[model samples]
Target: MDRATGTTDPGGGTRMTDRLLGVRRCLAAAPADLLLERLGTELARTYGTTETELLQVDYRLAALVPLSGAEPVIGAGTPAWRCFDHQSEVVQGGALHVPVTMRGDRLGVLRLAPVPDDPERRGELAEVATTLAHELVAVRPGTDRYAVGARTRRLTLAAEMQWELLPGRSRIRPSFSLAGQLEPAYAVRGDSFDWADDGQRVWLSTVNGMGEGVTASMLTCLGTNALRNARRAGLELADQASLADQAIYSYHQGIQHLSALLLELDLQTGVVTAVDAGSPRLLVLRGSEVIEQPLDDQFPLGMFDGTLYQSQRFELSVGDRLFVVSDGVPEAASQTARYGETALHRSVRRTRSMAPLEAVRSLLGDLRAFVGSDLVDDAVVVCLDWTGRV
Candidate 1:
């Protein structure tokens, strides 16, 4: 085997390939956290060593996350940037050095001990490292490598920025309360929710921009700003949606597509007027039963000019609830099943009698259980409760 050209013994190639494929299958079948653990086990098995170390590069902390095994020097304590500076493998008796790289980008270095350093062995290790790196990028939190369709540093930066724009926790109000939680919250890009009180009414809106990463984040920012301006101008729910649609259309030259829901809650009357554009189904829960709100079913905003959207009005009573969610909620799939509308409805019914925040937490907990782990796409859950007139 040659380390330079990735040449390997016939038997070694077959074994490595099998191991890589098996690892992928295992990861694909497991939850995010379990997948990491499975990866560590696979690495140990593939390397034919029990003492294996997996490190995740964290630039912010300037440290490496030890995915598995033990390395007193590099595990949990060593700074990640320091490893990049000291490129050469660090060995201090009973230790080994193996650099993990993907498409020329150095992710981190793996350290193991008591294994001989041979070209054939190193080459095989490199192949495994490459495969693992690709898997990490694919399944990593907050990233949709396939959806983005390209690998660039900008995508990571955009994801980070989008995360910063979200609400920190579920929100509470006197007449009405609203709260939202996003799955993979740290890596979300296009999904955003906003709420504002205009003394008489509370305006709530959630938007999911088309695509992912930088483009989606940019569109979301534009839509958010448009909604804010429209609300500030005392525009109605439908008018705010129209304004947002126009802003998106003009910004993208009529090329952007976005799903949005705008709701206006009149504190004095307990009336909720809403405009929905290509968003997911909204649910209104009363006691043990859940009712689905009818949507306009119009095309997503920004796809056409002069697209008129109508607002559906519903009267809210004390203890009645509203659930607004992104497609991610119903679309979340596990290895065996998807958490569809039925599951969502059941979850909502079970929590219909709970407080607004508790209901939101219950729905989120149910979603995580149904999906069996963190979701692949961004899941946004906005729960609103009407507590009688102000």
Candidate 2:
């Protein structure tokens, strides 16, 4: 025990502990707008830094919006995006940018300035930023200030409902990587993808529910949840699809339908069993080229009360990829030119070397750009890469 510093070592362990506790203690009391502001202040006081700022990646996919301080646009070819893009810190002359990511979502960048000259403290600074990111994720479900910061425009009720039902935007494991993207972020309806990895298998589904706005969102909700219920109840892949079809048909009756691909994948062996309901062919990317995996197509959900959905089995290699898309991809009109299967496959080949999230972004981003930045209908792209690890 040290006398003056109240710690065993001379590295100010006790002070750091006190500051961490202080930040946690203040977290519960601060309002949304002031949340990061307080964290920055506490960090500055503890680290002897001149200034601290937090920048969030806006939902528009363009600039980095600030929660409290100055708004900094991530200029073209700038290093700022590298912080969020690469999940690594960017250290410069006076300012340092750290990626504040939790799981696979690139939340934003934590920027601190007038950094100390000591190299030994980099880890400590990074830990602080990382902890803050975790705290933000935990608190976000109860508050919308972070969403307020991230949004570029007002979100529609249907888009909000759809987004609320989604899992993490991306997931990465040693044996596999998966990412999903939805377009018309502010107004999308009923286009959703969900997945789960239960050690032995990964369950995946992509659905496009019929109708518009809230009605479409409700139909999607019913379909996705019914599938989840059946799967979680230990039903087979075919049964899961059947249960979803039954639920939607029983409630919505004729005319309300969904195009879907429900799958069960063995994590260790790379085997895929799928039930396609007006679903596009599963595109498998091996090495640099993308190929379509053929499947026996079934009826879309709600098309019939007694549609017999069958499971088709296939095996994937170590580097194989799985792609699932809604009808929006092929139907999306860009200059009166739809995104045909050939172009979509070509785009995947072009972005094969990028990270899973980057690949999804590239695919969706290209589609949006081609359609003049406004997709008339909802579009989704789900990518999965199997690394065949033990």
Best by lDDT: 2
**Count of residue pairs whose backbone atoms collide, per candidate:** 2, 0
**Cα lDDT of model 1 by residue, 273-295, tens digit:** 88888886688897778898886
lDDT of each: 0.67, 0.79
All candidates: TM-score: 0.59, 0.89
Off by over 4 Å in 1: 1-156
Residue pair clashes in candidate 1: 62-80, 142-187
lDDT by residue for model 2 (131-157), tens: 777778778887888878777678899
Which RMSD does model 1 reach against the true structure? 18.2
RMSD of each: 18.2, 3.4
Candidate 2 clashing pairs?
Answer: none
Query: What TM-score quantifies how close candidate 2 is to the native fold?
Result: 0.89
**Evaluated with TM-score, which candidate comes out highest?**
2
